[model samples]
Target: MTGQEENGATRKGPTRALVLHPDLKSERRRRAPELALAEAVSLAAALADLAVTGAEVVRLARPQPGMLFGAGKIEELKARIEADEVELVLIDGPVTPVQQRNLEREWKVKLLDRTGLILEIFADRAHTREGVLQVELAALSYQRTRLVRAWTHLERQRGGLGFVGGPGETQIEADRRAIDEEVVKIRRQLAKVVRTRELHRAARRKVPFPIVALVGYTNAGKSTLFNRMTGAEVLAKDMLFATLDPTMRGVLLPSGKKVILSDTVGFISDLPTQLVAAFRATLEEVLEADLILHVRDIAHPETEEQAADVREILESLGVEEEVPVFEVWNKIDLLTLEQRAALLVQDARTPGIHTVSALSGEGLEALLDAISTALDDRRTIETLTLGFEEGRARAWLHEQGVVKAERDGDEGHEMTVALTERQRAQLERLRQG
Candidate 1:
């Protein structure tokens, strides 16, 4: 996927994209190094649609107080951009407003950092009203911070007074003000959306279906696995961040009990703060899930690192509650027999782990049975006898779980029921009278 661009290389749209890898050495050395590499790869895949020719990695000696990268690197990058005729410069790191403006002036091309590119992808992928609002809010927050960058909005109105307005009230400032206003408006709109979603969740709460959320590193085939599990086409692809919106579908497990499975946006190491703020609504799906299926690509070299990154992100979001997590080592079809056995043995040592190839439908029935058993284990089974007059409890028991046996004796209709711990407790309280 790497190449060199030719001079006067015209394309139907933009062809050449200059990618710069800015390593936050201090951060990586302190927190995690493998995650940094995963971020770089995810950024490359995010910009895959831009016809990227090649990428350069700028390993910073030390963090510059003003700009992240040094002046010498910037000069060399400018020369490289001109020589390659790159139209779009994608920085695989965060760029400040002043640094972004300076880079554009020095390189003389369209400059975008990791946060900006993720927002752009979200803007394209968002479909629902809430998702669109969240994206807009995040975009405005990001743009408001980086107001010095040159774009179509800046060229319109420069500095002026009287007819135009004050120099402070120029186009950029005005746009910032408008974005601020829009942010507030979008927040209000999202509040409504949140209320609507809460209502839907409350309705689902009445049902006894256990919820499972599919989570993994970006481009780890989460949506593909989701499609295979629920038979729902929710934008499966080989690119990073392919699925932005959350999709939920019901899956009937082997136990004949219906369970809900949700496909969510993939996680990436060092995901932008603006994006985290914007996609909170979507991530809420994972938080509310009854079980989490942490799908991983066993064939990937950095699979363990990716798993650590996913765990870190989940812990940060406070979803590390005792909700059972099943480690599903996916993409086993691509692995060799030795690799598969090794992974299986390793997974066996870890509690509640399984191996499956979602694409080839191998070892899926076992996975389903595992899910069913996990769901059933979470419930407290109770043996109960119901009178004939309590038809409502009998119906509730049938709806919730299995009704083992019933006898219509001389006194009334006696029934034995198996239900969840909560349901059993509630029935016990009812039968006490």
Candidate 2:
């Protein structure tokens, strides 16, 4: 029987879900409970076949060990769940295995914590082989810690990693050894994917175009901006994690200079550590970026906090300090006229900030001009004299199209080339060898 079937009755339509955000007073760096709950509802909406019935913030002085909520509170939630016929409860916080088990028994419904929900979204959205493997690896790592005996029947009924619910056959409980073996297999598959990606990167490096990567909080308009700039139909939506895998497209700037633009997965506050580690390889585009555009949803209530989260993740990824970063304040179309005017004034005063509404194309001309100018600043024209023996270096300079002028010389040739810092370094290495 499918997971939707209960007591011989096949459930119809989307699974009714209730989202709860546990507001712990003792926790540091706490977000507004209402906002957290709202985000959770949005997250629930991101998953297909999950209709959120109700959502609220549950205040707690402290958490109960066995059941995240106190006995009385648990009973209260159970009554509400029964009344609403909620088949699934999504907790916007971590829940231990014991706590999850107890809550499932008490509430008589499937429960997923924030991490599980995020994994489900990723699994559902991940279209690439690398992305799928990474999600599976992260899910396996998470499941290894919370595996329950005789829960294989539950595993078969979910669309993604079997966390929520789908259709499949009943299976045996997954032992730790079995989980470990699966992990190994996924890692092997992922290594192959990474190698292929590395080859692609190497090919891009040969093209000599600067890589500009867009990164920001989820639903912060990175993909929208990318589509507006590159004219590519990448999925740009209001949902969280609309674009999971990294996408790259070549764009010709108004200055007639070409560049590769990369749109990456958006960052969120308190992202699961397992995913952070697992998706590191996926974010290598940012590492190789010549410039990073930190897109911000200026209209979001927690815009500053969201920007902070993106910076934190970028730092963790060890992006080079030398790579130039420009802040793109997006979504001005959602702001009031007065607010938008004020933002534009502030943006003018900021050295590395640009304001735009990717949806409405407001201020995009200026943003694109700024991008072209920023890329130009990375390059410098230098006159160099190469010996006859350095034929390879001369060929490379011509191939890069950095050679602005060249003249025959007594030894070999003298050339004037406009080269970016990376190109200059490569030229020097060639000369040294």
Candidate number of the best lDDT = 2
Q: Kindly list the per-residue Cα lDDT of model 2 for residues 143-192, writing each as its tens digit.
A: 77786522242355555767665432223353676777887988888889
lDDT values, one for every candidate: 0.73, 0.87
Candidate 1 similarity to native, TM-score: 0.80
Query: lDDT of candidate 1?
Result: 0.73
Tens digits of per-residue lDDT for model 1, 1-433: 1222338662444347766776655654433444554455556556434566677666776767666678888787778888988777777777777877666667767677777777766766778888878877777777777666422322323211011111222367767777677778888999999999988876776676778899998878889889888988788877788888899999998889799999988887668888787787788878867789999887887788789989998988888456778888889999989988897887668777888888898878888999998878877544455677877766666655456677777766676665554455556666664
Global CA lDDT computed for model 2: 0.87
Residue pairs in collision within model 2:
157-165, 157-166, 158-165, 158-166
What ranges in model 1 sit over 4 Å off? 1-11, 30-42, 47-49, 150-170, 382-433
TM-score of each: 0.80, 0.89
Model 2: CA > 4 A from native: 1-3, 149-158, 166-174, 383-433
TM-score of candidate 2 against the unseen true structure: 0.89
Best by TM-score: 2
